[model samples]
Target: MRILESDGSIVDIFAIYWFGDETYFYGMPKNYGGLQAYKADEVTVIDNKIDFKTVFFSNDDAKSVHHWALIEESLLDDLLELDETAYKRFLDILKSEGQLDDNFY
Candidate 1:
C-alpha cells in the first residue's frame, strides 16, 4: 500500500524525471503549464501565510505566469509523520535522480 499528498502535489515535483531542474518545485493544484523552477539559493521556506502577491523567479528570469499554493506547516508535518515510509521512499527516488536533497523537513 502507498500514501500520497494529493493528485498533483507530490506528482508535480518530479523535476529530474521530467528533464527539468532538480532544484525546482511545484505548488498545489499542480498545473504543469505554470510549473515553478529554481536555481542556486532561490528555494526558501516560510512560516507565514502564502502572500499571493509574492513572486518566485528561476533561471528563466522574470515571469509571465506563476502557479503556487501554500501548504500549512502543521498539515505538512502530519503528512510527513503519518506517511513517513512512503514519503522517504519518494524522496529516495528523487535523491537517486539527483533532484532532492537531505534537507527535507
Candidate 2:
C-alpha cells in the first residue's frame, strides 16, 4: 500500500492484521506507535501527517471514511485501483474466517 502525503508525496503503507471480515483503516502514529482503527467519516492529518479514526462494518461507513481519506486525491485514486488478485486474497481470508455468506465463487 502507498500513502499519499499532502504535498503529493507517496509513502509505503502497512496493515495491522485483525480478526473479522471487514477491511480496517488504521492510523499509524509517528515514531513507532501502535495502530488504531478509525470510526466515523473522519480523517486526521497534521501538517500532512496521517492520523487515526475508527473501523466501519458496512460500505456506507467505509465510504464515509474514504471521503475523509480523500485529502490526498491522487493517493485515494491509486488506492481505489486495487489489484483484483489481492482483493480475491482478501476475500479468501474472509472466507477462512467464515465471514462470507456463500462460497459460490
Candidate 3:
C-alpha cells in the first residue's frame, strides 16, 4: 500500500491484489491512463466530517510506467510522512516521468 498526502487529506494507492475489496479504491490515478492496475482511494466525507485511517508503508520494488528506484516506497512511512526534502525528491521523479502536470492537485 502507498499513501499520498495532499494538504490534510490522504490518498491511498494500492496494487489490485493487496486491495482485497473494491469498496474504497475504485479507480487508478488519472495519470496512469488506466493501465497500471493500481488503485487510488481518496478519503470520503459525510457532512463536514472525514472518514479514514492512517496507512503505513513497506518496502517493495514494483515497476511502473516510469523508471524504477527513483522514488522508493521504503523511504516513506506509515503516516505517509515525507519530509520536505524527501517530498521534493519524490515529486521530481513524478514530474520527470510526466506523472504530474499543471492540472494535478
Candidate 4:
C-alpha cells in the first residue's frame, strides 16, 4: 500500500467488492473472500463475497447497517490520522468474521 508502488489489482478487487453489483474477485494468501472468489470453505466470509455482507454479523438486520456505516466512515478518517494502527483495526473485524485463520499467529 505505497501509493503508486502498490499493486493496483488489490485496489480493484477491494473496490469491486465495495461497489460492484454483479461480480467480485480478489486473491490473497490462498484466494479467499469476496463474491465469486473461487476456493474452499465456500462457507465463512461470505463463503461467497469475501467482501461485506450481513451474515458476517450476529443479530444483524437493516438496523445493523449503521454500525458498518460508522466503521466505513471512520476507517478513512482513522487511516488518515494514524497509518500505523489504522489497518490493524480491521484485523479484528476480519477475525470475528472468520476471514483470518486462528493459526495465522
Best by TM-score: 3
Per-candidate count of clashing residue pairs (backbone under 3 Å):
0, 5, 1, 5
- Model 2 residue 93 lDDT score: 41
Q: How far is candidate 1 from the true structure (C-alpha RMSD, Å)?
A: 15.2
Candidate 4 has a TM-score of 0.32
Candidate 3, TM-score vs. the true structure?
Answer: 0.34
TM-score between candidate 1 and the true structure: 0.25
**Inter-residue clash pairs, candidate 4:** 33-50, 34-49, 34-50, 34-51, 35-49
Q: Which window of 10 residues has the lowest lDDT sum in candidate 4?
A: 1-10
List residue ranges in candidate 3 displaced over 4 A: 1-73, 102-105
Give the residue spans of candidate 4 off by over 4 A: 1-14, 17-48, 54-73, 76-82, 103-105
Candidates ranked by TM-score: 3, 4, 2, 1
lDDT of 3 by residue, 29-103 (tens): 433332123233444422222122223323353222212322244323321342555445555555665645645
**Model 1 Cα lDDT, one tens digit per residue, 43-87:** 343221322322333455322212211132123233224455434
Residue-by-residue lDDT tens digits, candidate 2, 1-105: 334445554332323223343444443323222223542123323233223332322443333233232233223333334444433543444356443334413
Q: RMSD, model 3, all Cα superposed?
A: 11.9
- Cα RMSD of predicted structure 4: 10.9
TM-score of 2: 0.25
TM-score of every candidate relative to the true structure: 0.25, 0.25, 0.34, 0.32
